[model samples]
Target: MKHHCNRHWTASVLICAALAACGGSAEEERAFVASGGPDTPGASPAVAGAPVYRALSTAPLAEVSLAPSDVDFPNPERGFYRFATDPARITATSLDYVVADGQRLVYTPADLSAYRTRDLPSSYLTKLNTGFAHLRKQGLKAVVRFAYNYPSSEADYLNAQDATLSRVKRHIAQLQPVLQANADVIALVQGGFIGAWGEWHTSSNKLTSPANKIAVRDALLQAVPASRQIHLRYPRDLATWYPVPPTVAQLLAPSPTAAARIGQHNDCFLASPDDVGTYWSASPAESAALRTYAQQASAVTGTGGETCAPPVAAQARMACEDILREGAAYHMTYLNRDYYAGFFAQWQAGGCMAEVSRKLGYRMQLQAVAHSAVAAPGGLLAWRVSLSNEGWARPMNARGLALYLARSDNTTVALPLPGTDLRQLGPRESLQWSGEVPLPATLPPGSYRVFLGAPDASQALSTMPAYALRFANADTAITGVQWDAQSGRLALGTTLQVP
Candidate 1:
């Protein structure tokens, strides 16, 4: 496969001669000449002598270790303690407080209980928009859910808590504009608006039927932008839409269909063998199938939730060993850190809290990098990166990867790595991306610092430092590579000279 370079200017004849001297093929020289050369107007003519071609290969001088970070940094989509807030209650100060506590994800449930019998008020819709604006300003994303009620008592559970199917659809239509407008700040939308707490069960309106569930799921998929996914409360609900589990190839495919966009959220995670009816199957074989599907599907789509208090018999499964094992198996991205206080305390006392915190999402660390030591303007600069994802899951949201060339003056130019997708880098998976990118013909000869950045795919947040992915590697005497928080780039600790 031929990898096309994204340079605007053409390679000069001198660089072609240098390439030939460095053992490049005749066809490669012709391709570069055709791309841009003296034949073009205002193009610089090739010099008589060939430029120096210096190839350089370097690995970390010190041993690269996978040490967990003790400091909390802002990594967009994945993390612990999804701070919950009502749309009306969200304020910049409140969000700042959460950010100060190292939380990047917020959970906001748009309460529609009062409007169940009618359409959502204009004021309520404004509150929703305002809340999203706050999240954007605070450099945060939200796990949004629109639910009718929160049943706190047995009597409340027995009452008609949610609107009818027709009303639910209308409400979704009303919220569509807000959802699409603020999709950039939305992490994922929970499949809510059905039962109490929107867990897709025990609906007083009896909206839990298979047909009804499918309707709500489809509506939600349409209401939310295709870039964002919808998370159901149970794995069985997803199996209803996709009985056949996705193969490894499909899960790793570049583009996903709407069906693949539906994921799961287990509110009562690890509460029981079935996770409090999350996998509601009496038959052992059927239960096994559901569990397997959840594991495989969540690998691509994403999954996470809070821990419920387990019974005495189920407490064994809540230990550190089980937690880590199952966390990797299901590919959890985020978990509610506040609800299960006892379990959190237990993990701390048992000496696994730090590791759990470190591995909650995508903790990518640089292993090595190789590139050309020197190159002429408009010449091919071969580059390669070796990295590993140490976290339990890859980034579920869309992300763009680029190699940045920055000058000492802080002037920077980004060369997009078109085909590199961070979502494909799974948990515990190592990926090496290598390609040749041509330096701009107008680029001045200088020593440039090379850095790598994985920014949010959306243009609106792409340049924001808080939305950029951070590497797990720390800056120390041993490991030269370090994450630059101010610039939102990972310094490769290597330099490229353009002569």
Candidate 2:
């Protein structure tokens, strides 16, 4: 039970005496008592000459269900990386892939018989389609990457017999049907099928050249749908083709170009001075330009990869501070959770695991909300919602934002909130939007609590409240505050009285 002391009650009584002597309206004093009045011991004491505005608690909530990617509420577009298609890979708490996971698949293109014909075996097709179909069923998305070989591969997988440009084109062409069909579950595709480990380096075909890189990238772009983006290995790879990347404003603009669709994937993050050739230039000036490109591109497009080497003996490894700094600067949306267990182990040991987990993707919180206390059934219900982003990246996916009015009978009416685009909510920024939704003329006349909901626009998971975007705020319980913990909807606490 909530506990309050008599000390605040005594202080409020003294303040009421002073307010009465100063000609305070009896109606105003009565209003305060009606609104969880100070007569309830332990209520906040009013200031000597302050307006008696009714205020509710705005304190930060505990790190319980509100945390990002938690089992109950899975937010999209950001979170820890996962390597395999195994559903068992999720954490005991089901925190992994709350945003999305990285799916890196390798193939030996040398065996033309395997992919030479349009008549690919149903088994091979099943392998490709099954993972993505499962992701769709689970209500998840993934960053997909396909490679020809690895850093260490069996001799049978050598590039001497690998697919040539023509064969690679045909391979991508064959994969087009599956790729387009699964675009709903695919976050983006990385330009792979090149150098060792598909990092676009050390290829037997010398695919590192700018011309070859462009050709491969163009082929992949054609293979994947325009709705999806393709990530490059290095900054110069993007700069070489586009010459000029999109500005922050341009990235947010409608109808971005294919050039603007390109993103970055730094595999050797924090491994060396040049990140183990992820940045090949020796000149510091050139390195600075790459950094500038990465930060800018990542703001709009996705930027993510894995750590290659953990620091040795007190070196600047991927610590909690570095995670926050780089995540914000580069707007990293995802990371490989498998390879560098040691790096993350250190983060866990340092006691910042919770912070990293909470901020890995987008952590949207309600800063303040203002709305009318009463309205007619057919009247306008106006609201001003102030939200703050505490995560490293913005939500790039499309989601539906709507107002939920729930009656005492446990029924809810969903009113579409027009002109609300959540993708514009940038990292670590406070965004405020005000809108008036027209209440249905047929809405039952009763006391209905107001709530905000962001659901998958596809309507595939509309009934799944756990799949909704959970906000980082304290008032989540429906009975007291009308918050549906199963869904990420917020109950504004103020009731809308309909006459």
Candidate 3:
């Protein structure tokens, strides 16, 4: 897929400025509604002097670069962490380790091996709900998977052990309600429930066939919420299921289709030329085509996985340079930090672990901002902001952006940027947003602090600071604009005055 690294937005600033220059008359002023409430028109008398426009810009610090962060901070649905856990084992105490380690995502593999031949029990479903509740309370998200068995021995791998197609379908139907209820905490669901360890291999019932795979795919697409995505084990599987890869336009469509929602996961990443059959192709041309498709598909839907031990000859490919190159190519969002211990040790010894940690997912930073310093009650508050994404991928989930005005009395007004989806902000991209926000005529006259925020798209978690996206600016001392953990906002180090 083509990488979109540069985008620009120009708001109707000229129109608003023209009206503001006309004595800021109420009749000429636009009717504006604050996010918190509707607008109330109030009359404003004409000013006697020229209109004053104030602007503020960031200053550089000697010690650090302002565009990308080196220190680690918890952001949703990204970064490295442990995978594979039983639902009932997740508890507040168990999560202490995750928090202390500076992680915000976990993988939950719900074991249904016992119920492969029958329906899922209500008690087990409740455990699933309870596990997600724990994650929500701890300010974390889960990469979910449902599997019948985890085969460890060579014999287990050789045997066909998963349930028949009918039983798998029945189980998905039973678990749909639980999945829907906790969609807020689920980052994405792995396309599991077939083969050993749910990696879609070694299925005794031949579930790997194209027909059976499509059936399972259809069921999963219907089971999960439209806002979430499902990840399959290999790129070839997607190529088989969807003979024609989706266009960049279709993948990024406002309402994505099932094909767009399916993503890729590489369990044995970088272990071999084809990652140990994760990209099975009969010819070099076919392999290139599958990889190109994965790159395009994952650029929008998202992709992730874990590393495996390479052979003696392939050890060089596990080096820092190789990993970094492939990571960016795949647009990887997360990985298994604890697995394949030797490779991680190599990363630490090679002085690339820190870089890997910071660049795994989206690293958004505020480059600069310009805005009007003073305006009448109903006049427009014009603003222009420059932002950059320094990481390897865009945010896989939905996010909403807004500009906020707050007074000393704790009164806050929000002006949400309509139709601004951060998912479109590709890796290594820079964007400029310029817009005019209409102020309510009845807004009280005062000096209000300005802030910018990227909060969750869901109303239930929008106000929670835990789910808010924090910028990569170092601190208030280095960059005048600082991250406010308490309010989940970036204090822009400027204010707007109203008379």
**TM-scores, each model vs. reference:** 0.85, 0.73, 0.85
Q: List clashing residue pairs in candidate 1.
A: none
Report residue 135 deviation for candidate 1 (angstroms): 0.8
**TM-score comparison, 1 vs 3, better candidate:** 3
lDDT of 1 by residue, 151-248 (tens): 77535766647889999999999999999999998999988899888878778777999888878877887889878888888887778678876543
Superposed Cα deviation of residue 76, candidate 2 (Å): 2.0
Off by over 4 Å in 2: 1-74, 86-123, 151-162, 310-316, 408-410, 476-479
**Which lDDT value does model 3 have at 495?**
79
CA error at residue 26 for candidate 2, angstroms? 24
lDDT of each: 0.74, 0.61, 0.74
- Model 3 TM-score relative to the real fold: 0.85
**lDDT-superior candidate, 1 or 3:** 3
Choose the strongest candidate by lDDT: 3
Query: For every model in order, what is the number of clashing pairs?
Result: 0, 4, 1
Model 3 alpha-carbon drift over 4 Å, by segment: 1-68, 153-155, 311-316, 376-379, 440-442
Taking all chains together, the TM-score of candidate 2 against the true structure is 0.73
